[model samples]
Target: MEEWVIGPRLYNCYKCGNMICRHDDIVSKTFQEDRRLITGLHTVADVYCCDCGERLGWRYIKAYEEMYKYKEGKIVLEKFKLANENNW
Candidate 1:
């Protein structure tokens, strides 16, 4: 008999094919506020790709409102800049 195993799903940088993060690492999708969006204010830092230095997205450095405090220290990566490792 043969044994089989499965690996965790991975997402890679689309440009340089660098391993970015795992699918299970994603937290939420409704926490985005564009850097240029003026309706609300948030203090965030740009998140760059480690290998290629591509501007992948931003990290929530500070959230002004108490309700949004949970977003602090979280990062959001652009969907277009990610590729599933299995697709490679």
Candidate 2:
């Protein structure tokens, strides 16, 4: 089992005033790992707009699992990555 964490900031759609929702955010890389070493880190930010019925940005991270549930009764999975301290 992998432990996951979300930022204190809640993401909202820049194009719309819809509040972004997430089901899961999994981090495969630890805080100390080098991001460059990981090829194609799976970072997804699965989201959708109820009013416009548009698919928002998804897959923003290099290696993460993000799930979203929309008000219109829809579920999506998003993945993303975090900045690697080792890379700095």
Candidate 3:
């Protein structure tokens, strides 16, 4: 299993002012092929606040000449917790 470092960078809810941990939150990644005759793989990361549960922004991972958008959502922490508890 691959592990990613959960940065200490704090994210606060705009409405509730609650601190959120990225490691314990949900993150979605989307990927698609460019419609144009481009040559590259494109991907986007949709980061959510997890506190107020609002979408933060769409971070482009793979850069390409044309733009291709696809949405993929997952509750990473919840899945991890469930896996740890042997739910799966």
Candidate 4:
């Protein structure tokens, strides 16, 4: 549940031709590249691959009010699940 799959991409690490699964904390690290508070709260980050240090993607951080939209899709996706979806 850590990595968001049903929302806009937070990571697009295809340079290594690899794909990351849910909540892949070990694969990437995001560092804020630019942040502006006076502009009504916004943040930009650079996501890098943890393995080969490749640039993955850029992330736009948002607060709860605006950020909740990104999560709404996940909640809806939860309604469709296999019986053994968590068997791993």
For each of the candidates, give the backbone clash count: 0, 19, 0, 1
- Deviation in angstroms for 61 in model 1? 0.4
Between which residue pairs do clashes occur in model 1? Answer: none
Over 1-88, each residue of candidate 4 has an lDDT whose tens digit, in order, gives 5884454232223445344334443232332232343334544455555655665544545434564435222211111111122233
Alpha-carbon TM-score of each model against the true structure: 0.82, 0.27, 0.31, 0.30
Window of ten residues with lowest summed lDDT in model 4: 75-84
As for TM-score, the candidate ahead, 3 or 4, is: 3
Model 2 lowest lDDT segment of ten: 65-74
Candidate 1 structure, TM-score to reference: 0.82
Each candidate's lDDT (Cα)?
A: 0.83, 0.38, 0.42, 0.37
Q: How many clashes show up in model 4? A: 1
Clashing residue pairs in candidate 4 (N, C-alpha, C atoms within 3 angstroms): 3-23
lDDT of 2 by residue, 1-88 (tens): 9986644444444455455542233232133323242434354445566655556534333333233211122223222321222222
- The better candidate by TM-score, 1 or 2, is 1
C-alpha RMSD of each candidate structure in angstroms = 2.6, 14.0, 13.1, 13.7
Q: Model 3, 1-88: lDDT tens per residue?
A: 9996644444354555555444234443232333342445645565665656666444555554443333223222222111121112
Score candidate 3 by TM-score against the native.
0.31
Identify the candidate with maximal TM-score. 1
Please say which candidate is ahead in lDDT: 1 or 2. Answer: 1
